[model samples]
Target: MSTTTDTAPITIHIPTPLRAYTDEQATATVEAATVGAALRALVDHYPELDANLYTDDGTLRSFVNIYRGDEDIRHLDGPDTALEAGDELSIVPSIAGG
Candidate 1:
């Protein structure tokens, strides 16, 4: 991929529960080459969100699921999933209910 493509802006949808960490913004725009990079940028921009999204081992928390459009990243390339310009990644948290 070209430098321009790697630097393309990717929008990540922040779920309602995590909104408080992002100043209440529903979405965050970042320039990254992969889903992981975009996520890191978001956490870097909002340091407080790290503990909520990642485990102490530096891996994504199991309860958090990220999707690109209708497909989950795990079904794609996981966090290494390549991102293109205008790509939108949504963070979906798992909810357990009886």
Candidate 2:
């Protein structure tokens, strides 16, 4: 038997702090079924980025903010947020502290 996962090619906007890991590219395109998958694909290609975006246990770091268009993934379904073809994602690092 064979199985397939329908994935879409989505573009993730790279923030300045993480651009070096992405070869200085402003954006990256990855095929994924959800936001989690898309982020995994990114780290797969840029291994160094994984440590910065996720914690030791594989959970996304608290300071890394991800948005699907105008909506925050945290307000949606977190990493399980669904994606469609050509979805635009932005990564905003929480760089400020109280």
Candidate 3:
């Protein structure tokens, strides 16, 4: 059996809009193995972010975009994307149109 190694906490960048739920902090560090875990940590720590980040069905909100570094998580493995020790997750909210 293979063993899992504990890694350094990852940095999550909180956008201006969502900073309120994070106690006005622009960034947060969390120990997680995947993007989903990182996001869940945030939601768990700050329950207020739940409504904004997820839908009633517990899915990520359509207007909220998550990116690992410069790559969008949706193009990767969505929430299952693996994260590195120093990986940075950016949460971006989409703007609607015209």
TM-scores of all candidate predictions against the true structure: 0.92, 0.91, 0.90
Candidate 2: regions farther than 4 A off: 1-4
Clash counts per candidate, in order, are 0, 0, 0
TM-score, cand. 3 vs. native? 0.90
lDDT of 3 at 29: 95
* lDDT (10s digit) by residue, model 1, range 1-98: 27625566999999898899999999999999989899999999999999999999999998899999889999999988988889999999988878
Q: What is the lDDT of candidate 3?
A: 0.90
Q: Which ten residues in a row have the lowest lDDT in candidate 3?
A: 1-10
Ordered from best to worst TM-score, the candidate numbers read 1, 2, 3
lDDT of 2 at 6: 83
Across 1-98, the per-residue lDDT of candidate 3 in tens digits comes to 22244445899999897888899999999998889999999899989999999999999989999999999999999998888789999998888988
Candidate 1: list runs displaced more than 4 Å. Answer: 1-5
